[model samples]
Each structure stands twice: as C-alpha cells, then as structure tokens.
Target: MTAASLEGAALTSSPALGVIALGLPAAVLLLAVIWARPGAGAAVRAAASLAVLGAGFALTALALRPAGPSAGPPITPTATLPPATCSPDGGLLRVAASGFAFDPDCLAAHAGEPFRIAFVNEDAGVQHNVAVYEDAAGTRARFVGDPVTGPGTTIYRVGALDAGTYLFRCDLHPQQMRGVLVVA
Candidate 1:
C-alpha cells in the first residue's frame, strides 16, 4: 500500500481496539490478584499496581516528548539569481528538495509576476511541502501546498505578488529547508 494510504488507515482505525489492548493486561493482573492465596493476594495486588503505574509513566513520557530539530541540512542562502522573465504562459520556478534542503536556495522574480512553482521531493520516506509566507518568520502564510512524500512532486500556482522579500520553506522541516523569494 502507498504510504499515504497506510497513514490514513492508522488514523481511521477503531479507538476501541486501542482501549481494549491497554485494558486487557490490567484486567488480567486484577484477576490474578483476586485468585491468589490469601496472604499472596496483597503482593499480587501491589505488583499489579506497580505495573499500572509504570505503564502510565511510559505513556506520559511518549506524549510529552519534545520534537527535535530537523535532520536536514542547515538553512543557508546561496547566490540570488537575476529576476526571471514571465513568459506568455507564466513564470516558472523549479525547486528540487533532498535531504532537508532546496536547490537554489535564493530565487528572484519581477513584481506582479504570475508564477508556477514545481516542487519536487527526491528524498525517500520523507514528507515535505512548500509554503510561502509574507514574512521570514512564516507567521503570515500566502500559499501552502499539500504535504507530499518522496519521491513526489506538487505544483503551486501563485498569483501576482508585490515587490518584497517573501519566505518559502518546507512545512515539515522549516528550520532546515527554507529560502528567500525576492520580488524586484
């Protein structure tokens, strides 16, 4: 099955299955404690309580773990290309991504230029997306493409933009995969 389909299945599976899986062991331990010899019952109950406590601690640790930094290359701007001319169809920008970095990290275009960006993800098993924002901090998003797993491609069509320095990055690896879109 495709990776996307598998992820969807995992998300849509019945919650009852998870509940049953978690509760079955506790229930078994409870039954064991109840059926044990009179003096041994207390020890069994204590062991069961410790097991439940350990499980709870493990679940909490998994839920509260902090997401680490991106494993991709560092965010460094390379040379800025000259402004691209808009053709009769539209201006075209090609971006290739692999190992958490985009080729041609800095791009240039004329103001009010209608453009289509062809974003290609070449890294296997990595999910990436292209998003454009009005600011470098990415607080004001202008365009966000659907997340695509490698090897895959997504085309993002952007309307005419005013002269400014826009920010573009992979939403999944924003820290490592980012670039500047300079409109002159």
Candidate 2:
C-alpha cells in the first residue's frame, strides 16, 4: 500500500486506535473529578472521583502504549559514505561503513526527488551491505542495497519518498553501522 494508506492504517491499527478509545474515558473521568469537587460533601466525592480517574489514567496509558516491533520508530546505526554523483539542486551524501562504524551518522534529503547514495568499503577483509529503512529505528528496512564485498565500492539509488524520518545501515554490521535519513 501507499504511504497515505499506511498512515491511515496506522491511525486505526491496534494500539493507536486503542489508545484513542481509552483516552476518551480517562478524559471524561478527569472532568468528572474536577466537576465533583464543588458539590456538597465535596471531600468525599473528590476522593472517590480521583480514585476512579487514577484507574482510568493507568488503563489509558497501558492501552495506548505500543507492545511489539511497531511499538516505536525503527533505528539504524550511523554510516559513512563517499561523495555521490549528485544532480544540480540535489545534494550529495557520502556514508562510510568501516571498522564496525558508520561515519557521518545523519543525512538530509529533499522529499519527492531521486537521489543516489554511494557506498565504499574502506576496511579490508570484510564485506558490507547498505539497507535503508522507513523508520529511524531500523526495525523494518525499506530498501536493501547490494553487498559490496571486501574493499570495494557500490552505489544505491533511492527515489525520493514522502517527507519523514528514515533509517540506513550496514546489513552486515547493523549494530555497529547505522544512521538516520531525514527527508524534507
């Protein structure tokens, strides 16, 4: 599905929609607690009202919280690249993946425009691959580049996506080499 569709689906998906549903009751209970404070026997009513509100708050927070892989935005390790064959008005970004690290851990790109990412393996005796992801956390990878095995270089062309945060990393060393890609 398209991004718009994904966003729409996200809005209605399990935890997101559940949180909204639970929040309404919590809000209502909080209002009730406030409103009950000015009535006769205010202290007694306030205490009971507050107790109910507290329970509602707890439940709401639990229901809205994400539980699994989709619980939070994905992440990618920092990366370093070499200079790119950039187009006019399109910037070039070079990320290097060497020694279990990605240099220049962040990049910015314009939305809806094509761009090229050049990958070079400066370290000897190791193979590396680049993968770009939709989320910053790197949980779900959106684009996977070919592995530039051993002391060589490769380039990955990524089309401009909708405005949002993204992730990129070396598949061979995800923990050590990753970074964020911000699309404006």
Top candidate, metric lDDT: 1
Q: What overall lDDT, based on C-alpha atoms, would model 1 receive against the true structure?
A: 0.70
The digit string of per-residue lDDT tens for model 1 on 70-173 reads: 34565554334224332233377888888788886766666787788888999887889888888767778988989888999988888788888888888888
What's the number of clashes in each of the models? 0, 19
Given candidate 2, what's the lDDT at residue 179? Answer: 71
Would you list the C-alpha lDDT of every candidate in the order shown?
A: 0.70, 0.67
Lowest lDDT 10-residue stretch of candidate 2: 80-89
Superposed on all Cα atoms, the candidates' RMSDs to the truth, in angstroms, are 11.3, 17.2
